[model samples]
Target: MTLEEYKKEFTEDDAVGWLEIDKEFDRLYPDQEPKHYAPPISYMLGGEYPLDGVSIYESKKQTDHFHFVTYGFSELYYNEEKVNGEFSKWGFELTFRLKPFEGDNGNPPSWAVALLQNIAKYVFSSGNWFEEFHFMPANGPIRLETDTDITALVFVNDPEIPKKQTPHGEVTFLQITGITSAEYESIKDNPGTAEELVNKLRENNPLLITDLNRK
Candidate 1:
């Protein structure tokens, strides 16, 4: 859209960018109400967490799994001055695909929300951004207090969601996929091999869903 049109539409609408994100999800899941988790008070008003919210959606694309998407990583509010920039705040948001475990009962677990928030806290504090093939050790089981061996994470572009252009800027969805302890060791020292590892992972798991029970 033209800059003049953008100003006319979003001059006073603070949720211009937010609505764009919702539009994408709405197209993919019409009439679906995602399970949303947000801080009691917003971070702008001194909430402990940096992320504004995370939404969990039920998916059965390749298998039954929960799709978690994060808000607040980018410029979710309207700012007239930043309209000409090449990218929004960070130019990207975080996403995750998680397979349901035995006790999930068709609902996303609280630990998953906490995990996303913790990652957001790191980005907000450290000014670091995640990219495809980048990996991190979760220090222990990704699901805390669980016996699962999925102890690491690696990033890739989400297969289903493509980058979008909003009046604010461009946004990319970076999917965070979990990895096992052995998989972590294989790529920790050799970051260049991360892509290769992901390819190997996809041989059996096409969607690269994070399965906590899998060894």
Candidate 2:
């Protein structure tokens, strides 16, 4: 899309990027009924979260991973940068493929939702960004309810969703996967170990499953 065309008509009419992303998703799962979750009206009015919503789709790809895609990480409005050509403010929306927690039934975990929101908040507030293979320490259990020692997470570009070009800029899809305690320590001791972990993950599981039992 040309800068003039995008700024004048496209972005002006539709401020939501979610619909476009949804179309990309639908192409993968035709007519799938993804359980969509939008924050309450109050949250939109004035709340801690800035995202418009999150959509959770049960994946039949393998191992019953719950695919969580978030909205509001990219330019969701007719902002001035639509013409500036600097990728989306953060250039990526977070995607998570998680194995179902045993007691959670088929319901998506709210903590996963909260984690996405907090990451969005960090980007919007601190101007920090996440990219493929970028890792972060949770300082505690990622899933607070579980005793699993997967305390830190490593980011990888989502395999299913390719980077898309939007009027605002290019939006990349990043997936977060939990890493084992030993991997975290390796990263802590040698920052370069993170790249090794990413390589190992790609070798072992191209999908990057969060295997708590992984040593």
In order of listing, the candidates' clash counts read 0, 0
TM-score of each: 0.95, 0.88
User: Which sections of candidate 2 miss by over 4 Å?
Assistant: 7-13, 41-44, 79-81, 211-215
69-126, model 2: which lDDT tens digit per residue?
8888776666555554568767888888887876566578888898888777777788
TM-score of 1: 0.95
Give the lowest summed-lDDT range of ten residues in model 2.
Answer: 77-86
- Give me the overall lDDT of model 1: 0.86
The global C-alpha lDDT for each of the candidates, from Candidate 1 onward, is: 0.86, 0.78
Evaluate residue 138 in candidate 2 and report its C-alpha lDDT on the 0 to 100 scale.
78
Candidate number achieving the greatest lDDT relative to the actual structure = 1
Worst 10-residue lDDT window for candidate 1 reads: 5-14
Q: Which stretches of candidate 1 lie over 4 Å from their true place?
A: none
